[model samples]
Target: MACAQAYAADTFVIKDIRVDGLQRTEPGTVFTYLPFRVGDQYTPELGAAAIRALFATGLFKNVSIRTTGNVITVVIEERPVIANVDFVGTKEFSKKDLVTSLKQVGLGDAQPYNQALIERAEQELKQQYLAKGYYAAQVTTTVTPLERNRVDVTFNVQEGGIAKIRALRIVGNHAFSESTLLDQFSLSTPGWLTWYTKADQYSRAKLNADLESLRSYYQDRGYLDFRIDSTQVALSPDKSSISITINVHEGAKYVVSGYELEGNYLGLDNEFRALVKLKPGDTYSAKALNDSVKAMVEKFGVYGYAFARVQPAPQIDRKTHEVSFSIQADPGRRIYVRHIDIGGNTRTSDKVIRREFRQFEDAWYDADRIKLSRDRVDRLGFFQNVQMGTQEVPGTSDEVDLDMQVKEKPTGLLGLGVGFSSANSVSFNASVSQDNIFGSGNNVSLSLDTSHYYRTIALSSTNPYFTQDGISRTLNVYYRTIRPYTSQGNNYKIVTPGVNVQFGVPFTEIDRVFFGAGFEEYSLNLAPGAPASYISYVNEFGETAHGFPLSVGWQRDSRNSALVPTDGRYQRANMDYSPFGSLRYVRATYQYQQFFPLSRFTDVAFNGEVGWAHGLNGRPLPVFKYLYAGGIGTVRGFQQSSLGPHDAQGNALGGAKMLVGDFEYQFPFPGTGVDKSIRMSTFLDSGYVWGENEPLHLADMRAAVGIGVAWISPIGPLKFSIAHPIRTRPGDQTQTFQFTVGTAF
Candidate 1:
């Protein structure tokens, strides 16, 4: 007992921590788990804490704390390292998916395995199944010890029957009828066409998202105090049926009252007051009121009030249900820029953005100039993120700093893909593009395509800052050959090569005016099945040694974001005339697209395109320049390049006029994290080609209904679709499929 007391009294102080049995981990890592560093007191609590912390790392199976009187030591027997990972009976996700999901919970390649990680991974997997309505799913994790202190893991999952939404019942909604609320929910009992929509499945994620949508719908329209009171989910005894209840609180609506303004406005009161778009007797809208305040502050910015504030005071008249707002402007400490910091660009050069800035460091701040700067940067199309922030500088009341950051993405792309169908038989295309060419303010692209009857090569370039004066310019050079179908195999090939340069001057932020001119030459070769109408035109007016083509266009693209547009309008109208070229022709095309946001995940887009080509100077327009449709970009249900005038053999004989329309609904993925990168879409595509005197008719046009999946992969966008022809003639096929390996634009 005396020796034991003496040994206990001589407690060891840690000289240093030496960790062993670590392969994938570092020694310093173990030190972070140790409570006592070098030259510290070690107690029983500290020893226990060290063991627990080591175990929490999920890197060890057994952690032992021992002390030999004056020398305390910690020893750990790490779990066998992961030698391999395998999945069994999992078709919902791939092996890489399982690996990624397991790694999140601590089990990964080259990492030590612990029972705790296995339990966590099992729980996660079960939760995922529950989200998909698989409440009775079973997941088992087995660890097999291997050689070299490693272990292999296998996850066995037996996903049972998926719980379905047996019924949907609404309770506690007194103001509105139960039927009204039921229409808002996407999840419902199976209907006659449930096999297609899958509304019968009850998903927790879907329910939660729907509830949020409901809340937003009420709040945005003046239910400022809307709240989701509670939600309850119940499963039947058999675990095959699920029931959900959502309780909501809809508060009373409030009206705006008259208000008065205070705070001093330095010689800018009239200008700022004019910005208040709201007046007395208007409905109370928090969104509109907030926008008015921002507008007032922005007006003050013109006078160098970078740090301006607008406070709105409202006086409510309960009896009259009217409200008036009084606004006050505070121009606090007009500051000059001291420094500017640019960040977040990993692949693009900083100079590329700095060149677009209209506001300079050390100059007085201007809101309009700053907004223009942002627009210029966003137009680059090479970044995924862009933000600007201002910070006040200490010790100086009239100085501030600005910081701008951008996230960069790949700027160059080259893609090649082929498609084969019964109609087209075989088609191939290649494209080389650079969105941001050499860090310069230009976009350049070259494209080539060839089939049995047609061949085309085109080069295009666009400069955003054309003349060092902020104007935009675009240049194009195209060489194309077309072989007309003939009964005697004597169809002729028309070769047309031309170049165009267009200069654009912005009329406003949303509109631009473009003017350009070019030269072209057209020559024909005799081939089989040549059409009489086309042959006469080529022989009369299409045989030109040199001709001049002049054009003028107007464009307005005010879409919020070009990659995935919502809530904006894109309009373009152009007319071209080649009077002196190999052929005398005049052509005109007009396109319009409008996007309406139905919800965060839903959008309604309407697009229409019309083209008209005519012969001039007593000659017919060459058929080689005729319009073609019924492809991925045109009508979706029919084979690509399959729409136009057809011969006895069902071969296309080009046309002079065309029109098309598109209506699409893009669906969002629940867990993909690729908000803008992956989307599922359904579209209705209709269009048809016409002869000069051919009458237009709804019956002659073909329409298709289809669904497709688009992914912005590392290489490029991968789009695949399967469509069915809704209106087809007896001889026409009813179904088709297509895929494109690049950006849809």
Candidate 2:
């Protein structure tokens, strides 16, 4: 029906068929598309039909049919195959990516060449650059013929300058200033931070998001009738710059005049009523109302109503600027989970994650258990993301399936580097830590230090599933040799080696108890000019001593995050007692930490720790086990382990009691957006260490106030602080600036 040329011929008895002018297409392919057979009759109508059939295949550029005697002949020119597809002047996108885009449109290497497809590709390329703010971009395509019916396609592009926002303006604001309203926008005009923030770039997605932010700002501040009337993004004729204008209608503000419940809350009206957060006289806030409704739904979900329907019915009184609302609820039929499906955990075993889940298949849906399950899995820190969902079983109203998905991340570290902690003068070290060994949920670590002042080796292992009931077991072995007092001709050294075993039992989701026992020995060899403090210790307790110590601890952590907590409380208490052996003493320590979320982008944290040790069985606490403080983890601006009493040689003498307190206020760093990983904070730190015979005095504590920056960088967590000591006595070692960087090998 779509013949390009007419066929004029007379009917004849056919004897054979022939095809000509095909370089790559076989003769049989042409026969398959022909309307007439070798022995069939050939007429003018039949010849036209044959021509149309062959042309529809798209394999040929030209098709014609002729009849001679009883034989029919077809002549065709096969379309050229695309030999290559390339681009020039395309600096905005990679060539491989562009090729992929072209392939989706049937225009790529080895594809049939068509002028229509080539035009489409050129337009598509221009559209892509437009989306990236390149309004002046241009694209042109060319087709080059080659021997053997082949062709090469080329796209030439000119990616112009990215249009930037020159100005942004907000209109129709009567109650709030323009500057105040813009605080909620993610989009901004060009500024000093343009290079990193790219705030000047104009994209439809960014503009939409900024408009939503502006709308939420008004809604949260009691403007219930607020609406965005119009928005205009204007581009300059030259296409080098753009400008945005927003017009908002902030209607009358409303207050919560009254509210009531109208729906069946499953006879739990008392529980549902307590969840209402709005007061009659308070200004209406969209966020608070949404949260209250969400809480009510979750409460219903706890009773197996997975498909509960909750709606807010509001009554508006325009004259009085007041709003009244009622929550309408419909409790769907109780549903049971038909299956518990886990996915996206390729490296970790199914059992390792399933054991931590509280929700199970064929059980009544419980929101609390599901939430706890998700939190526990998230707290493992083995995944980058975890998500949960429920899907109703097809044809089953009362059955649903629980879906848990996770995104796995590296839970081990292996590195070789020449890095050191800020407190150390010179250092090189190697360490390996695997928190999820072989994806079995066990942990092990080994660290070796060969610094100039000391040499050390330590190994630790933990089995979190030691008893299958969540009881954990840990073992640690360490050996260290200290040569701080060594010189060119005289060498004084202290050798110590120890091993410990510990077990942990969880009493609740947020609390745990630990108990352990260990054996430790100390051997010190004194030189002729040994420090007086070391000589005194050797004279008092001899050169060799060992102890078998028992330890007990209680820990509770309710933080929402382990690495960068915004709000929560954490506490830990530990005590070690040595009732017998040459070295006998009791040491105890307690730490309490609290984080308060001030706003979405700011927080406050407070930390307090105290420790005390005393000798038992008429023996002094060993100098090695004494409590020490005054460092980055303790009171900043002071030397590490240098806050205790000092001897005539100005050497720090370990103390029996220690106290440290730290307070910090964290906020967003400029040009970083809302990323909590990088933050700036100002802090106050104070601590002190008292000797065994010295009396506790608050006046003796050293305090410092400083500012710092914390970033979870590519390699690890890094902190740099500049602190100034405010209280110090004679012989106090102070440091004005300090930083800490981890080393790995």
The total number of steric clashes, by the backbone 3 Å criterion, in model 2 comes to 3
Error of 2 at 489 (Å): 13
Model 1 residue 680 distance off true place after TM-score fit, in angstroms: 4.4
- Tell me the tens digit of each residue's lDDT in model 1 across 1-745: 0011111334457665565456556777788888888798766667767777887776777677656644655666666788887888776667787788888877787877667677888898888787777888899988888777888988899888878888677666655676777766777787775555667788767787778767655644445566878888889887888887778787655565555556877765676666666655555666677888888788777667987878877665555645677777778877788887888876567877887787888898888888778877887788767788888899988888888888877777776766655553456788889978776757899999875556789999998777766688899999987654322333666787989898898887778888999877777765555656656765665454566888989999988777777678999999888887565688889999999888867677888998889878776666656777776688877765567677665556656788999898876644333376877778888888887667767677888888888888776878888887887664443337777787423
Cα lDDT, all candidates: 0.74, 0.83
C-alpha positional error of residue 46 in candidate 1 after TM-score superposition, expressed in Å: 16
In model 2, where do residues sit more than 4 Å from their true spots? Answer: 1-3, 9-15, 41-59, 337-351, 360-363, 391-401, 415-424, 483-492, 527-530, 630-632, 635-639, 648-650, 665-686, 693-745
Report the lDDT tens digits of candidate 2 across residue range 368-422.
8999899889888788889999887899899999899999978876533342223
**In model 2, where is the ten-residue run with the lowest total lDDT?**
483-492
Looking at candidate 1, what is the lDDT of residue 257? 54
